[model samples]
Target chain A: MQAKLDKSDCMFLISDEKLNQFQQMIDELDLFTLVLPFVEESYQRSIWILDIWYSISNEEINRISNPENTMIYPYRNSILGIIKTLPIKRYIQLALYENERLAFLCAIYIYNELDDFISKKMAIKEEVKENFDALKKYSNKSLRPFFDSKYIEYENYPKKLAMLQNTVVNELHEIHKKYEIPLSWTFEKAIDDASKVYEAVFGLINDWGGRVP
Target chain B: MIISNQIEHLKNLYKDLKFLEVIQFGTITLPITLQEKRYDDALICYQYLASAYYENGSYENFHVVMTEYEKLCLTYGKDENKMYFYYLYSLLQVIVRDFDAAVEATKKSIKYAHFLKYHDLIVVNYYNIAAQLVHKKELEKARIGMSLAKFYKNNICESNITIVRGYIGALYYFATMGNNEEFQEVKQVFLKLIKDRQTFYDAKISFAEAILTLNLGQLEESVIFFEYAYLRFKEQQNIMFLINIEEYINNFNLGDKFQYTKELREIIKNSHRKPLDINNVKSVLSDLFEDDTSTLSIKYPNVISKELIVQHVEHALQNNETLYCFHWCFITDEIEELFGKLFVEQLLFTLFETVYHFIFKHNAEVNVLSKNEGEAFIRGISESEFFELLMELEEKLQSKVVHSKMGILEVPIHFGFIHSNQLPEKQASYEQLTAHADASLYYAKSHGQLYIYN
Candidate 1:
């Protein structure tokens, strides 16, 4: 079962729901009321996803190489796998609303993985290695401050996230000619891939430092 | 579906009082609700967000959110939405101590309620109006408002808290006006309404009681109530009441406690109402709106009803659980009128702290559970261990010297308890156990006993 939390709950956080809520929301994105807004959301969602994927992997940086098809993303399986492994519907939050809504959908999966590790009484050496592998490749300085244990300041987390939001906004505005702006991805896929980096830090902060805001 | 799902989860969070989470998730979905033309869902988002901000003591955020809520209601909302809009608007004004504006806002809500024929909303708005009016010292208008509240308070299922608050609002009016009989009447009914359960507004009642006793030349008598109300309001972070209490306590000479009280007040007043730290986070997307044709149909554009509309609520009764109930009463029943002035006043003033501190050891959980008044339980301990703790409390209470200005030495308190574990069957309904506790409490008080247990 997922935990219920709130602003008052501080680091523990708020909004409790089941897997179906997340699933239902993702399914609903396919039925957008407005075509323009829906497609725009899809584009923004893809931008966020590529930013996240690029942040972790040594992919063609800031350039989405969807030469085969504008709609078909290279990491489609991994993105879907991340969502499939996630216990709760966290990325559902990313599917609608903002131009760039980032939730670190993988945070849910990562947190759940941590939970499994803890309950199974397994050392997190393997998980930590996987996390660091994802972490070290980031070209963006968004996760710069939160990289080291000594630098993990909970008070500064929101500020850093806000900074990341600004960075994402600027990136969206430029629509870097270096990257192929995918026209083929669905809103559901875009949303599934959106939301990056912070929640991973959020999960780690919770797991190691037990500090969140 | 995303907006609706988020709204559904936000509603649940609000219901669960996970306000921080409400703010958390509400922040994410509110824009979606607005963007998707799910205005009602958007309104729900605003409602939860505003409340969450308020509950979290993010007053600046609260005001910001309410302003947006009001804007949303006016721009896209229909009649019923405007009614609720003004109702919430009234609350926003009240928080800032703008009594006149608050009263006006409430009356506006009442106007909408009248149009919608929502008797319950009318009742609540009248109560809100009464609260603001009382603060403004408009006793006659407040009385009328109170009467209106009482008339429409006939409706049942208005959520247990709202009904209780309506009564408390009326209680404030009656108590403030020195309508002692009406005050007592409303208080008795309210007490009956929440005998076995604690309420969020329990401190507000203490505040009213403090004001009533103060009016009756019982300033010293009012100290305990004021102190209780102060602590509780501080706990609740109810700034409005805390400010009101600060005004009262300025006249009170609580010595070191007053200084501590002043500091505590500063912390509470500053805590949630921090100026919006907008510098750290500016809106990156200032105008996300497309100004397209609104997905929602606009209706009932006329803001007010042409004719005065009235609706009556049908009266209904509702009332609760029990385990160990310890009723701690002060030992002052036998005092003469002459001694009452010097002894009772000085004694209360001198030792209320020491006494409460002493009792808090044994009765803090019980006091909080009962809101200082019904049924409480003790778990994770054997019945014999409980008795041993009780006996130890009695022993501690036997001799204690409280230093004060008058050099007042000591005071006694009566402890009455209902130990259900000691009962033959140890299985009693909530009512039976509480009635038994109340009986023992009264018995101990009348008999002038140190300890009485059933």
Candidate 2:
């Protein structure tokens, strides 16, 4: 059931080898195995991931086909689109199964890549910066740059990185309170961990001669 | 400490249904709780945010907030909060029309509540389950569920709000089953409970009073009660209850139905008139019943003919844009015939006007086609827009009031749609488009959907 549901709409966009490597990473991280005990819960997470992929692919396809219809900033669109897919129910399910957090992390990592690609392709840094400024009003000052270069320290061992991630999560909680952003501690932790995973993946790809495909 | 105080402030706003304010404050409240590493406080904020989003019809945001709430419950929340989470999840499912899932989730809530020995939570879950059963039309089972709710209310926690809600649920069940005596009994109890209380339950009491009077054949009094209820519901933004009142009004019957409806409309229009004159009410009964097309004319314009449909179809095909053909058919022909051909035509026209407004609100283009056949077409619509239109139409049709010779009639409408792209349009022609849409309409009618797409 997991495999059947794992057939993402965006799977065709990537090479088979790249897809295999992504799946291997997911397996190595023991994401699906952690969710194995809860059938309905796991299935819901799978559906959510598929939905996110479907949306991202649709946006990508639309952008490619009709460049004139680009109304929203690509980076903002990708971030908001991915966030939209992770509603409260899925968040809880992922939180319940610790391993499932990896799946969320993987999704964010992929989206970060897409965001980068769109930003470079369209040369919309000024527009992207303006959009980020708008988003900053809703977020805290400390956690404003939610994704940053500090997370790309792949040379730091996983356990050390995990400790660093924990600190970021703790900081985010304070930021949330200071800013009065309506978010759960669990959600804050999940998002922080996802950012860590995203940075790690980017660091890994960089180490592998930056051959993302 | 300050965060809790802030939460209390937002809680007051939430109770007042000041959703926008609550949401604005929540942005700060949620982050503060999280930043302080107060998972429990964060959970509470999520609950408030979720409810606000749900009430405001921002399902996507609600889903996001609820997910966070659920996560917190699993991670750090106590059993009571977990039970509350399930209860909220069930309510959200019901709003989205997932009845089976709602029932399952409610059962989970009840289980958790029972484990925690929280009688109030258990009773609330049972009440919700009963409400879902009522929507399912399983009245007997709903009655049993309501009985359980009442039993729990009596035994453990007999709060005024709980008792009022219990009575309201009973009233709804009895009214739906056409048990007028039982309905009146429940209404009396409900009214007595709110007789002297300076509470927000006045709107609910007035609603119960409206139903009771309507059942007792006191049409004028019922109309007044209904108007009062509508005003209160609108102010509170209690859309669900408002929809219920609209449904009840749709089935209203007076001796001279047409004249009474006209007078009711006039009274509603006269917003400045407070403590309405009894003479105006009496004049409604004596006034000559004129079939006025004025209201209908103002609401609906540019009624399309069959020839016009062909032109629209040609234009859609030429532009390579998607055309959404919607077919609406009344369930009861007898009711239509009783209302007279002209009156029925006017009603259909008004329905078209409502649909047009609804479509345009979603930024979709709509054109009324073949007014006599109750057909219309929309173009350049997305799936989400189509679904939103269906929801709006369902609410409209359920609540729309029309007077007929045989008392009052709530004509059940069958709606179906087909996309132009779905048609076998080797050559884009009206014959092919209509034929395909007609078939989809037939399927939707048989399948009992507001609208089915092909």
Candidate 3:
């Protein structure tokens, strides 16, 4: 499940039967709870499967080979497995949407993997060895220009993923009230999640210096 | 006072130092100081905020900022500085639909600018005024304004020439005169501007293209561009624009009675014999034509139709089969002068997508007659013609219309036309028969709009 993703590693095939099944479910289920199932299988190693499956669904997971394919996986995975990775401390932080705590937790879990993927992709190093050596050579103040240049440049991200995230977040909020989720938790989670991702990315960049402050 | 490059740099540094952290923390400061409070800081602040808001897609804020800027300028002193702010203010007014104010502001700005010998401000003022006059449907005034603007814009900076904006000037000029050739030429230029990313005015360019095509009686082309514009407007959440597009579509009447009558007959003919209880009409239509529904909607009604339930059936058919083209093409050639090229093209795209989606989503089996087929269908073909021979046998049986006979019958007919001289009415009913023949031809094409007696 955690194999290096290559062009040939994945194929997107929608069988007529599968489409029908999804359509049928769409008709019957509340659209908010509507989930499309996807599974990745590897021979033996339950822990590895669990880690990969959870990682695949998590938003913080970097290196999303196929965005559309990876997107459906989060909704397709086991809810319990997803919830377990969302530590109690994180869960409490998401207490703003207390009633829909489970849903927020699920979203946060997915958000984590997404954040990780985005950070890793944007985190530029001149060369593995060069960046590693920069830490030994350059002081923090000397690194200002290099870091400043990074922030000034804008990168285009696929809009569909952004739309998908917003849609999912909105749908969760729609269901939160019925499931007893508080609006506050949703807002808090967004802020916290964004901050944590930013901090983590900053740490990753700092790590190229090869010595933790 | 004028400053050298070195001093200008110092000025910029001083300004940056004055407002740096405040700007970062979301504060906007004017480069000009208001010692006497005779001028308005609100004008500069709102203008800067509006620029940022436009970038962020907060159109609501953009409107608010513009409105505030306008109010500030309206109340502030009239001077050289006023000329510069007035030009910017008028541009915003044009965008925000305050066309009258925009026109007035541009005029005032130009007068003050010339008096102050502010050449750059004069060009900006006149250019923006011309743009607003176009919006106000003042074609002659807009043209005069453009000529004046161009005279100055040309002399100042060769690199700063807004070629795309100039094309917009040409679009309005040709559109107002109803000169189809010139309109097309200007439209092509504006479209090239959009494709080349020469302007941030993609929506405006699209709107202009939609309007020009619509004015040229190119309904299909106009609708496509209008739909694109509609989507962009929706993203911007410009409610006023949304309403304008909706109203424009609602009033679009092609005005040709013959075409109207023909379209009516086509609609009526296709309205009968629809599958009941299928959410997906296209899939049902597919099954109706091809005798296959493995790929069709699973939900099917117990009865196709019951005479006792005629009203309900008719309502269902109407809901399922109707294709509504918003018809952005209805705006007279006169109104084409009122909109920019981008606005018109966007309106056209919106109309096209709406109608296309309605047609495609409602009837699965409805085959889109190829352009050649459509032409062939509308124009009658003789018996010796290939389509005539194909439909000859189907006409002989006249079996396609009967509901029970609908299943598993391949009618030999050219969907292009039928020489049905004896369509069950008097010889005086020749016009009616021709109309039905067109409907039958449409049916034979087995596009969802046509059905035959099985």
Candidate 4:
């Protein structure tokens, strides 16, 4: 009945205060159309990053309790320290490679946050309208169809969510099986993966001149 | 998916007492589950298979399955499954008449059940404890245990608890206390429950009824009920109950009408008795003749023969002499497996030899009824003398150290006795006396005592 926790040597480097601020931004950015997909994609991407960290790290971290102290921060510092010394082109390549599968998730999060602000109060607020128009100009063409087609109304949301979750679990199972990871490693791996993806997207937005919503 | 469905079906079959089908289904599923690395499923399969084997009286299969079950419990089983494993293990011990070991197993079961907060399992274990106590004749302790069981049953929600056994215990308690009115009241309730529930198919209910009827002085009705119960048990292949029923039937002199002649013939045919050689027969006859000085010429046709022994004992019964016949049954192969073949054989031999010497030393006429089977008949002893002799024998057996090739050991022996004069007929045959004694011996063995008399 007692489940063993993962002992992978990866850690979340973000402080509790910064994590709280990021969570607030997510809440404010929530729209039914974009937030569901963003949440699902972030969950999948987080697990992937955690799996990669577990495969690469030599240090065994106790992930059962106090993940920040025991696992996440150490992993974050190690990864960041290694990446900071890399050339700008190499850093860019690494970010792009990691964020490729997570592109739809980030685009949906950004578009929903912008659409909600524009529809709700942008017309009456000139500053808000200006910021929204600028954000739209910078938005990728690949993410435009999501807003134009009213996809949320046409799709079976529950079925889509279930299919997405099944895909994520199957992928995680494959990774674990391939690496001969113990069952105990699963839960901690998911938590570390989600936080890493969140941090990566947050940094990317900061570089792209977008403040936290 | 199909496997899960089949497992559910097997469970239903087990509940319905289709034990054969359950075993068949479990046999197929057990390997499949193991092959798939579903150890949890394998444990469940073993549970069903072992129980089915037990119900069917296939002790060999039961033993094999239980071994596997124990191993599974160690590896894959949780506390809940371990509790059930101990519970079933206790039942196996009970079947083998290892009451002490059974009590210990039940204690273990109670411990696990308590830790798991399984109130129903606790109630069942308490009931099992009460039953064992009753067998040990610790009536007060048994009543207390049964009271605890009842308390748990009442406190638990919507419990489908049957109070038939509780009523039976109360009946025994009052009967033993000589409280006729209370005994009658409890017997009425017990009988009513059996009737209303149509539980006559269960041999135990019939056996209990037979005992109650015998206590009420309805000997004829008791024989009929006992026979009904015995035949039912035989039909169900419940060998343990059959053996107990045989004992109860033998204790009373039911005359030729309820002698169980057919069953006796079956047993005799199956049994391989070793006949005494001519010289050994002569020596035994000479010893008997030399021991007796009475004018009554005892006719010894053949020595170490059941018929010759019965005839000689019947002569004493006809003369209105106070005579006691002691009946003993060796542990069968099934029992031997549980208690170890060597231990059982050695114990049987030692007890028979000790009793033979003690009876001879006491100036009683003893004859070996069936040497290979460990059965004997003794006569020319009064009822009081018989009881005193048993008490002495019990004390001696308890204290006597048996020196074997392995080491020194003390083996427990149980026997049964019946006085010829106690038979209903003034001119009862040797068969009647021996039967009664045999029945008494069964009671003695079951009750964890040295001897039971009628």
Candidate 5:
């Protein structure tokens, strides 16, 4: 709300009568916004706990790919079912019902949580195994310096960038390859995409505007 | 003063929580104790050796050790020896996960203690049975056993550390059994007994507390207790038990616990424990536990002020952190009317001491709040974790009953909590957080819920 107050355009407060109505809306909204902090963290954790279900790195990929781990598919699929169907739609409905823009942070938190579990087997540059291990150890955001260093060689392997472009431009079957290892996208790119989901839940406000009253 | 260096070395290693080291060093001393016919010393050595075998997961070697221990029991068994034998056997039975056998052994030990007129051991045995019965989920039998434990509580010899240790743990089982009257009686003795004596991290007691709380659907409380047990096991460096705690967290799906149990996860990732090669160790001794032993003798709080809790809230806001501040209010005005004001003071004192003692053992940083109101400030947690931990602490505290000389008074606890994350300002917002907690407490007090989180 402070962000909205400080950062709003003069057009949003064009008239004295409009400004008074905005104040009235905020007074009513504070009653519901007071409960969103609780909603935000619960949804945030509900998202993070899905980390164990994701098979990200090659080692994790291999571990889950093992025949012995086949039984865990049903459980993982159940979680995926919830992620794919329930939350995104439900949180949108919630924001609409509450008539509050901040309530949509719950949806974004859930989106970011499910985004981390998006995994596919990709062959990266074979030489950067050490860099792969380091990336596994730390975040791509923090490891940006390592990638940009003088001796690094991440020319063309990750495939995620091309995958994203293909996703935008092509049909569903045309986007994914059957089995061609590429050097176009790096693990760095993949993690960066996930980490780009700003932690808006903890410090959420209604600056983005509410529903039409 | 004339203790054998070998026996002294073994005992020292045992006391240091180095059970595996004790097993390695004790291979030589067990034969020496047997050759000398030091029955008392041999019995004590067997107790130490069995404990090591238990912790080391050398159960096959433990079976041989028990066989040898029984021979010595039969040969030199008098009332004192027999009582001690059954007691040790019962303890070892628990190590083997045989609850029924342990209860039967405890009953036999009780009989011998009865014959020998060893009142402290009798109380110890009864409470031991109560503990075992509770573990078996035979709560009705456990309640009866708890009553017998109380009947002999007056005879607990403080000098006998074993008896003192045994009786001090009785306070939790009544809480576990939900026997309010028995819980009240034991609560009094528990507070008075532990007041002067110090406490060590008993992993066994911590395990029981963790499991009992978990069974009560108090997952947050269980994780906190399990965390304490994990720390205790860390001090012992028992890789297997530490891993077991990790499994329990994963299995129970406790408290968004993957990150919460990160240390255990690290241990599981890094350490690989091989089962103890008892055959190799026993080959050195020529027999696993050719025991000679001696009788054993054993020897062995911070509170949060309200102002400090508010200050921590302010500090957290300044630093962009969160603090879960609990204002635990005791609804004792009715108690003051029913009993006198003086009796309520003692009940509050018990509450204060128990809370303080718990805080001290966990090394939680805080001061003693005033008698009537208590506070716990858990720093930097997510809201979900706060609710889990709040439910746990509230149940544990609300179940607290005091047995004053006037009568048993179950103090009604109302826990109100607030976090700094919800506040608007960094500078003067501490008052808002605390007043929110105060209002939460007032709501809980009036509404009669266990807690209200603001």
Candidate 6:
């Protein structure tokens, strides 16, 4: 009797080739796996990373749109939530994840580039900081600043640098959309993701670009 | 804390008594120029004006202002001032019964209040938040929030903190696992204030004293203090205090032989038929009479039986030896036989009855009124000498005939009565023993102008 060729097995076989191509694309773009290195093995750590990533950029988007309303309690609190969750430890770890090394390297490079770009435009930071301090004193009153400092920083970055940063933020947005997660929860999740990425990258690099001799 | 135009208006009103009166008289308008739109302006203005009016004793204007404020908040608004306005507006809503709206607005107000470091407002917001949580049966969270509110009030507030503290204590006392000690402790704090005479108003102090006495089962003492409080309130034109007293009196006046109680009940009933300020008392009486006693096994109703009533009268008679002459004299001969004189109770009853009859039957002449002078009169004398002096006075007042020359029934009729004056304030014995003498003396003096030291 002829062996029945299992259709499902054939489908899986076909998908393995596509998986290979997808991995190759991930390597080339360094984007698909950008968050992967940041994600810990544990479900909670992964979720935390997701939260951080989503809230930070979503807050940035809100600050960009209503720059006039940026320094108010709700707006400033949203930004502060992101600032508090920035994964200082995990940003250095993303390099060591087998599938996410490229994405890990790229996220840091993009984040640094954006920070550098904002620093270069000293005027915007000064103005934003002034308004932020004013808000501290008179918290009851709503504060509106003259310029969109967050957007100005975004626009001033080099095109490629900007694209990479935008891609990382978009990936967070996509993860949030896929998970049906709240923006705040997603930002919280992303802090863990970023910390994992930091650990992976540091681990990968500290091994002298290889395993311990 | 914001020191907005509302505060400015309040400052103006409080500048002088005339301005306060003027604020009451005219169409009181709040400074609404601060906000951009009329609706938002009115929304904020109404709260400030209402509070100002309330503080200034302009209740009519306060009501009007709150009504206007309610309308502005309910109207649709996307204005930036909506959240800010809602903070004050929601607090006002609680005073009215827009509880659902207050709950919603309170959450938003808390967020704003925290941002501003307005601790007082934050405390109020927390109170409302806790109240809402309680309504939803979120007791644990409500308790936590209430604790936080109390913490803030303790740290920041000065005068009105007692009110919030009392509220918390009451909530703990009734709704939670608070013991009698907890309730008694709060009560003692207030009681101490009353006992020390630190409380300014006599009526207020007496009312608190009455409550404390009642809680301690000093029911007769409580009634006397309540009467004092009731009279003081009436003299002061304080309708609210009068109502509170009437309510308490109605709860306790279930006894059989209390003649004053019947008089009081009739007066209160007549007052209620008119638009007297004692509507609360009327309602309280109606509720107590309508409800079954099983809910609270209070001692009052049972203590009103005929035998118990007679015992109370007897006890009152013993307290003041002279008051034995008023109502005790006329016990039926049958009662005297059944409760024989060989029994101490019967002997005391008979003595009281005999005194009562003796005082009423004849015009007993009481000529001299003199205070008890233990020190001034007997300081130089020895114990024996002091005894001789007392015997001399006793003989002179009781039997010796120091008559005039013409002798027209001129034996000086001076009763050697012990005066109740110059008594130490804290002596329980004085209170326990003196009332009967004073009452009898007072009755004697009123009836026949008899001179008795009391």
Off by over 4 Å in 5: A1-213, B1-31, B39-41, B48-67, B155-159, B167-172, B178-205, B212-218, B239-251, B258-454
**lDDT of each residue in B1-454, candidate 5, tens digit only:** 2337777887777655467777777777777777887776776677678756755545556656766766666555555666766776776666555788787677767766765667777777778787888879877567656656665564344534335446434645754664446545654555455454333335645765676677677777777778888887777665656766776787888738534477677776776655433232211110111121111000001333333444665566677665655667677887888878888777776665555554434323443333466456666566776576555565566677766678877778777666655545532254444445555554566557766432
Model 6 per-residue lDDT tens digits across residues B1-454: 2334544554444332233343443233344333435554454455445544543333345556555554454443332234444554554444444566665566555544544545656566665566555655556555655655555566574533223312332333222322346445545554543353222244554666676566667778777777787676655544444555666676765233223455555555665433322211111111121122211212223212222333443443346422211111112233334444344343333333333233323322111101110001111224354345434543433342223344523222222122222323222122222223333332333333232323
Chain A TM-scores, one per candidate? 0.19, 0.29, 0.20, 0.22, 0.21, 0.20
Q: Which one wins by TM-score: 2 or 3?
A: 2
lDDT tens digits, residue span A134-175, model 5: 222221111111112221233222233223323322221221
Q: After superposition, how far is residue B291 of candidate 5 from its true place, in Å?
A: 19
For model 1, how does the per-residue alpha-carbon lDDT over B89-152 read when each residue is reduced to its tens digit?
6676666666766665666667657556677677767776777788898765666566556655
Instruction: Put down candidate 4 lDDT per residue, B304-416, tens digits, no spaces.
Output: 44335656666766676666666554444444555576766566566566666676655455455332233445556566776787777777667755565667655546686
lDDT of 3 by residue, B227-338 (tens): 7766676555544444445544556753331123343333335545232221211111111221121111122232121121223323433344221110011121222345
lDDT (0 to 1) per candidate: 0.48, 0.53, 0.38, 0.51, 0.49, 0.38
Off by over 4 Å in 3: A1-213, B1-45, B51-59, B67-78, B88-98, B116-121, B131-138, B157-200, B253-454
Per-residue lDDT, model 5, residue A65, is 29
Q: Give the alpha carbon lDDT tens digit for every residue of B1-454 in model 2.
A: 8998998998787655567788899988999999999887888888778867765645556666776676466556665665666677776676556787776667666766655667766666676677777778776557656666665666674443433533544665665455678677767776676566444566766776676677677778877887787777667655555555655666664324323345444444553323212221111110011122223322444433334555766777887877776767666566566767777776776666676667556434333324433556677788688777788888886677776455666766777566777645563455445544554554555556665442
- Worst window of 10 by summed lDDT in candidate 5 chain B: B292-301
> What lDDT score goes with residue B291 in model 3?
19
lDDT per residue (tens digit) for residues A1-213 in model 3: 111111211212334443343334323221111111101111111222223333323334332333443343322222223333444344333332222222322343343333333224223434432332322221111111111122222213223323444444443333333433333343346445433432332222222222223
Q: Model 5, residue B387: what's the lDDT?
A: 70
Which is the better candidate, 3 or 5, if ranked by TM-score? 5
* Per-residue lDDT of A12 in model 6: 15
Candidate 5 CAPRI category = incorrect
Looking at candidate 4, what is the lDDT of residue B227?
A: 81
Q: What is the lDDT of residue B72 in candidate 5?
A: 67
Task: Note the residue pairs that clash in candidate 4.
Answer: A11-A71, A11-A72, A12-A72, A46-A193, A46-A194, B247-B439, B250-B435, B250-B436
What value does DockQ give for candidate 5? 0.01
